[model samples]
Target: MILTVISAWRSLLAVAGLSLTVEGLYYLIRYLKRFRERRPPQVLFFPAPVTCVRPLLLSSPGHCNCSRSHRESALSCLTRLLLSARRSLDVCVFTISSVELSSSVLAVHGRGVRVRVITDSDYMALAGSQVGAFRRAGIEVRHDQDANYMHHKFAVIDGLILITGSLNWSAQGIFGNKENVIIIKSTDVVKEFIEEFERLWNEYDPSNYSFSPKS
Candidate 1:
């Protein structure tokens, strides 16, 4: 019995030795490979205000099953940019209906930020449209019903930050459809979106209508 126990202990030690040797060889090979194929750094430093906010790319329904998490994430990213407004906000999107996003718009507007919105005219009467809410709050909101398609999803914050993405401001656009939004801090880009918004706002503005500034 004692001999058998001793033999078992010897076998255990042999296995442990073998494992240590294998581990040592693996680390040594990894170190050599890294040393032989060392690469340069990939990130570049920029002096300008070029930066990236959280990017939420949701998978499309056909590509992958859409979940509530994806929708909420996309909405949150939009809301984050909305809440950061201080001076003025110019929004040009196809449609918008998320209560969370609408609430954020109202919040920033309430704090004395100038808010202008241009959307698709057909969506004004859509079931989930928040056009009424913005109009009621005295926000300058218009719709390009006359145009064949006013398909733009972007927001310019204080004429300094620009948020442009594929995601619409609706339940499906946020949570269901696959989308990408890019927020950039460039005056030239912001100017381009602002110009587009002005062109649409002018075309949709009716002489008989009036939107009084609440503040």
Candidate 2:
């Protein structure tokens, strides 16, 4: 009888041990499934009004009474932005002829800032267009592949600062025309302009390109 009791107790203990092992395995499987099924994090953006705002630098030629030197012109502001860029510069102007501005852009390009220039198919042949100077400097330049007129006058610097206005990058626009060049310091605004710039840049198609502004 005692032997029988001992055998029964051994069987009970074995069954209890097996049950504990099975329970542990079941809980481990449940934990793994929950870990694998959890959703990934979502990306969010703040609205414009609540989004970050930076300094607003303006260059209204009509508002200034400064000397008629490159140092005092609206182009100086653009040159400064080119000099300040550490990463990238996207320039979409109708025409850029000022040698000072071109030299500044070339300096940054030499320093390894990715610089892209887009101009109008018709305007690049203007007597004062600096398209040749840009090409000579080994800068990547493109124009509207279509005759629809890529008359965009804006630039995004370092993915943060945005420069846009009626100001063209020419001696006339700087010295002759009344222009308003706004230097906006908003990441969100810059992103929007950059996105649009990229779209135009890709569509213009520089693969089989040439600079033949129609006479």
Which prediction has the highest lDDT against the true structure?
A: 1
RMSD for all candidates, in order, please: 17.8, 13.6
Worst 10 residues of 1 by lDDT: 41-50
Worst 10-residue lDDT window for candidate 2 reads 45-54
Q: Which stretches of candidate 2 lie over 4 Å from their true place?
A: 1-73, 208-215
Give the lDDT of residue 36 in candidate 1: 46
RMSD of 1: 17.8
Q: Per-residue CA lDDT of candidate 2, range 3-38, in tens? A: 999999999999999999999999999978765543
| Residue ranges of candidate 1 with Cα displaced over 4 Å | 1-72, 208-215
Model 1: colliding residue pairs = 71-175
State how far residue 138 of model 2 sits from its true place (Å).
1.6
